[model samples]
Each structure stands twice: as C-alpha cells, then as structure tokens.
Target: MALQVQIGKTELKVNPIGLGTNAVGGHNLFPILDEQAGRQLVQTGLANGINFLDTAFIYGPKHSEEIIGEVVKENGNRSDVVIATKAAHKMVGNEIVMDNSPAFLKESADEALQRLQTDYIDLFYIHFPDKDTPKYEAVGALQRLKEEGKIRAIGVSNFSIEQLREANIDGYVDVIQGEYNLLNRDAEIELFPYVMEHQISFIPYFPLASGVLTGKYDKNTNLAEKRGKFFQKELFEKNLEKVERIRKIANEKDIDIAHVVLAWYLTRDAIDVVIPGAKRADQVLNNLKTLDVQLTVDEIQEIDQIF
Candidate 1:
C-alpha cells in the first residue's frame, strides 16, 4: 500500500513526504530563482506522487504562491494535491511586520486564495505570532476561516510550547510545522510530548539542516556561499562530526546519507510528515528516494546517540 498519513484529526490525508517551496519563486529568499524552474519543481514532485506542497506568503513575499498557482492551473489536478500555505508576515512601507489580527489574517487568506487561483486551501497556518496578539485569538481567526470552508485544516508554525498550548486551547489546530532535524532535537524535549498527547500531526521543516546532515561537507569544507545560523565555524565543525558518524552508518547500509537522515525522522514519535525544500527537479527526485531507505531499530538508536 502507498504510504498515507491523516493530518492531525482532519480528513486531509497526505503522502508522508512533502515539498517545501521556499526556493520556488522565492526570489527574495534566494538569488537566481527561475520562475519556469520553480514551476517544474512542483510538477516533478507531483509526478512522483508527492501530494503535499508547503508554502508561505512571506516566501518571495507572495511569489511562491503565485508560481504554485500557475502549476496547479496548468496541471488541472487541484483535487489530487494537498496545498498548505501560511500568512501573518507582511511588508508595510519598507519594513516587514507580523500581524495576527482577525482582519489582517482573513484578508491574507482571501488574497492567498485569489493568488493560488483556488476556491479553498487544503491547509492554512499562522506563519508567526506577533508579540501583541493573544495566541488563541490568532488561532480563532483561522478557526473562523475554517468554518467558512476557505481552509480545510488549520496549522501553526514557529510557535513556542506555551504559544501552542494557547493556540490549541480548544484543540482546533490540525498540524504544527517547526524546525526539527537530526542536528537539532530540541523539539523532542517539550513540543513532541504535547503534540503526541493531543494527537496533532508534526511536520518538520529543514529536515536536512540546510544540507549539513547530507554528508557532503566536513569541518574543513568552506560554505562561504551559504548564509544561516548553522554556518558558524564552531557549530559547523560539531555538526560535521555528527554528519561523519551518520555517514559511516549510511555507508554500511549502502544508502544515500540524505535519504537515511530523512527516513530516520519517521522513526521518531508523532512525526507525521517532513517537508524539505528543493531548488531543482533532480533534488525533488532525490528527496523522493528517501522513501526507499529504511533503518533498523538498532540503527535508529545508534543514530540518535550520535547526535
């Protein structure tokens, strides 16, 4: 049987692996973005049975959603795919701001709908929480939209444990997307327990740690071209050491290190899905190859200890 997972308690069932579209039409996030190539990335993933596509409004500041909308229109299979998009971050004048008020969120949803060229979205998320807005109030706005059939399910990303507790006060959230990878197991300490207890689906972003866990780099390798929190020399060396240990296991298993790292996430509790961004069609194909790699119980423990 093909792998299928029910997103939280909702009826929206999706493939375990998904495509995160930060690099798709995300001209602001990355340099050298080709609109046609972005469209092709979505097509390639869908062709390979990747039904879920995670995107955000701030990604390209609306560019990613526009490209995804183009692909869905051309493909003519809107019902066959699961689309998840988020809002809350917007540009006002020359500065970007986080606004979770009901009015702005509802406006964001309507704009997203028009941009996506769809009547309804599969999943909608509050991309981030503003300091002033009560967490539950922000969730309430999404709740209202869900009631109107504008979004199938509600999700929240980048929320703290306390913030999540407030957002899901009435148990309305269906999924939670956060950064969780082999290099960063911080989610396990608190977030996982609550999501497990509430039976909420946990979809992890940056599952590869910006490719640090892919075994393609070592301590001496210079990643001057990359920009992120993981680029520091001390942190890079520590992660490189962990990657080497993971590489040894991957070599023994005769599997791609990226695939091994991704598959290992499924071994964790309450990790319903993982969305790793891809810039090229081949990268999407490579991510799909992760489904073919499986780790044994002992291997899972060993890999866990290595981190």
Candidate 2:
C-alpha cells in the first residue's frame, strides 16, 4: 500500500518508503549497474508501491535521470507517480560551480524535464545550499517554476533550519529534504519543527542512515561505497551501540530492523516522506511493508528512549 502526505500546497499520496536510486544510478564507488537493470529497478519499485523516486543531475552526472526517463516513458504511467530531481552544482570549465541564480535554476529544471521525458516535474529541489548565493534568489527561481508550471513544488536537501526559514519567507517552501533518521535527531530539534509550523513537507534523505541504522552492517563488515560518507571507522563503532538497541526492540516486535527504523520516522509530527535508496526488488518490497507496520504511541515513546 502507498502512503499519502500533504506536500505543502500540493497534496500528494506517495509511498512512505521511497526508493532512492543512488546505487542504481552508479552514484557510488561500486560497479555501475546496467542501464536496463536500472530502468527495471524503477519499474519494479513502482510495481511494489514505491511512488517517490529521488534523483539528482549529479547522480552519475545525469545518467540516472536518463535511465528513469526511459523507464517512466516505457511504463506510460507518468502522471500517476511523482518524479523529484535536484540541480545546483553545475560543472563549469571542469570546475564545480554553484549556480542558484534564476537563469541557471530555470535552465537546470528544463534540462531535467527533457531528461525525465516529463513536461512538468512533481517536485524539485535545490540540491545543497551555496553559501555565496542569496537564498531568496533561489526561492524566487522556484516560485517562477511553480508559476510557469515547470514544477509542482519546491524543496531543498542538506539544508539547515535557518536556510529553510529564509527560503520560505517569500512563499511556502513545499518540501524540505534533510538528513533525518532514528540515529540523526538534529532535524527534530529545529528543521523538522519549522517545517511542521509552516506546513511544509519534510523529506528525510538518508532515512536509513546510509544503511547503518538498517542493521545490514556491523562492526566487522563494510557498507556500500555509496555510503562512504557515513562509514567512518569511528562513526561505525559509535553506531554499534545504537544498532544493538534498535535490534533488540525489533526482535521483540518480530519486525525487520529497517522497518523498525522507518516506523520511528513515520511517527514524527511533520515527516511527509522518507527517501531511502534501494538497489533490488526485494528491498523495495520490504520498504512498502513499512506503511502497514504501525507503531503505537507507547511503542513510539519506547523507541524514543533508545535515540
């Protein structure tokens, strides 16, 4: 079953367990997947009730969006699902440059539209903040997209609470995509509450903590290279204690560790979406099951104690 949430002004019913394509798009140190398999993964993810697919122009430098275009076009249910993508760090003269200017934002959205084979994007985000650019300039650009029907909603990822509040002053920032999970409660302190107060949707990236909170990796094993940013030796050891606590609760509930982790987020006040990247069909199936596993108020309180 798919889950629904109010994504700012737009009311969208998406799979609470979104399928992240970071792995399929060859965005990591791992071997790149075949284009066919990548497309198939999108199809299979949708078949398994995953409606939210997050991609960025930098995901394998646009190869991921291209593959999604192929599969979304092949499936022809283009309007039935939500297609979200991001752009801001454009490569210029072989150097990375942040271009949150109106012209570049418009250009980038148009390029994504062409690559995704869609006329209008359901959701779009500014990948990361460029300290150099004025935040309102980016917000104005997103507002323009909404007015022109290029994108339905606007959001940002890897943003701080101050940044989000600044962006939405001119208008409502539809979605706020930040790193949030059972292990990461930083968002809860400020970003999550702000979004809740303003009626903006919260899309938590790394909702699985790059798989550390998923309990798939332990002290002895390594994680996928896509997760290298979070797989620090010290961080890994620190996570072991949290992992054991999560696992103990999950074992008593007879649920998968990942499900337990996701359920905790679902109970959060303002979380509208959780975009966890997936590589296989079975993973997508497991993600969909999260919507059915309800965590009651008492269970939620118990889970909070471990965090």
Candidate 3:
C-alpha cells in the first residue's frame, strides 16, 4: 500500500500524491479532450494506489465530478478513495458567479453529492470567497454538513490569509488548497506558518507550476501563449535558469525532473498533499514516481535556493 498521511486534524488519511481531476472532464477548460482518456487516467491512478481524488464543481462545471463518480461506482472503490471537491460557483442566468452564502453552500453540497453519486464527500471546499458572505458563516455551513454526516471534512480554496482566518474561526477547516510550486513560493511566506500553527493541511494545486517546473521547456519556448500571462518573456527566461539548476539535481539522482519537484514539496512544512492534474494514463503513472524520490536535507535546501 502507498504510505498514508493525515489531512489536517481530520480522520481521513490519503496518499500524499493525489490525482487532480480538472483535466478529467474539464472539456470547457481545455479544448479537444477525450472523456475515455480521462476515465483511463482515474483508473490508472486508483489501480496504482492513489487514494486521493481532487475535483471541483466548477471543473467542467459539473462533468469532472460526474465522470469520477461513474468511475468510482464502476470500480466499486468508493470507500477506498478519499474524494475532495469544492464549490462556490453558482449559475446566474447564463453567467457564473461566486456565492458563499450559507443557503447556497448547503444547496451546492447536496447538488455535488448527486453529481459525485456518493452519500458523503471526503473533503468539500468553498472554492472561492464571495464578496458578501462572512467567511466564518460560509464555513459554518460546511461545519453543519460535516456534523450531519453529509461531508467528512471542510476546506477552503483560493482564500487569502485573512479570509482563511475568518473561515477557520470555528476551527472547522481541515485543508487549504491554493496555487503553489517550486517557482511560486509565496505560500511558504504568507500561508505556511498560519496553517502550521492551526494544524490545517495544505494541498497545493498546480504543484508543478503548470509544467514549467517539469524542466521540459527551453529558453526559446513561447510559454506565454501556451501556459498563460504568468510566463511572459522576462519571467519565463528567469524561471528557465532556475529549472536548469533543478534539472542537474534530477539528472544526478537519475529521476524525472517533475518527480524531483513533487518530492521537494512533500518535504515542506504544512504541505500534506500535492494534486497534480494529468490528461493521460501515462502521465498519471509518471506522477506516482514522485513517491520514490527521497531528497537529502542539503538537496532540499539547494532546491529551495534555486527557486
């Protein structure tokens, strides 16, 4: 069995490396996706000992959870997997808006339960903080759900430090998900200490910085067009230099650079899970390679300095 770690103070124990299901049925996010391939990706992950499956209501707007539900039901492994999903996006007459109100949060959890085809969610997050709802009040709703046995744990995503503070005011929050990776270390400065103090597990999304930390891109590659605005010319070139340094360590260890990167995150404080999304079965298998990588303290510091 893959080694298990606790998610915050919750009773849920999951493999440190989880499958991020945004690409599973996120046809709306990525053009020209194959639903069959997406199912294969989940099957491959579960077969290989990955127990944590992270999804959200906004991904495919609902399809990701539906697909995951079908796969879990077909495999009859619902009890074996620790499924984590998020909400907060509500349809508003052909437009989507963030809603953290208590009623909406309660309604969203019930709807997500249907989409996931499960009696209870392992971890459910408030995907984003709406402008109106008090953060604590929103989390209070999820706390109620937990108490009623509708969900197992409560989480908050994309929340600022202050918002996280308010959400966890009652100490009901179990995990916090946000953008974090080797290239982006802001969480280390702003979020880690707080979560560490509160005993909340931190699950980093985009753990590979959307593949930039994978050490596959070259200086000439146009990442801006491919990845997004964050990879503009100057910043991309600087990050490439850092990736090269990590590539040397990866080569020395005889492992894939992406594996080295993921391994490094596991060593950091308060980071309990790293959910890297994959579109192919092979890619899903590749992510599992991260578990075998054991970095020395000096190497960890070297990687820390490189980024």
By lDDT, who's the top model here? 3
Ranking by TM-score: 3, 1, 2
Tens-place lDDT digits, model 3, residues 1-307: 8999988899999999999999999988989899999999999999999999999998898999999999999989689999999999989999999999999999999999999999999999999889999999999999999999999999999999999998988898989998888777788887999999999999998888767889888987866478674477888889889888988889998999999999999998798888999999999999999998989999999988877
CA RMSD of all predictions? 1.3, 2.2, 1.0
What is the C-alpha lDDT profile of model 1 across 14-105, one tens digit per residue?
88889999999899988788878888999998888899999989889899999899898888889988999999997899999999888999
In candidate 2, which residue pairs clash?
Answer: 20-277
The clash number for model 3 is 0
* Model 3 lDDT, full chain set: 0.91
Q: Which stretches of candidate 2 lie over 4 Å from their true place?
A: 27-29, 222-230
Total backbone collisions for each predicted model: 0, 1, 0
Task: Provide the lDDT at 39 for model 2.
Answer: 70
Give the Cα-based TM-score of candidate 3 against the true structure: 0.98
TM-score of each: 0.97, 0.92, 0.98
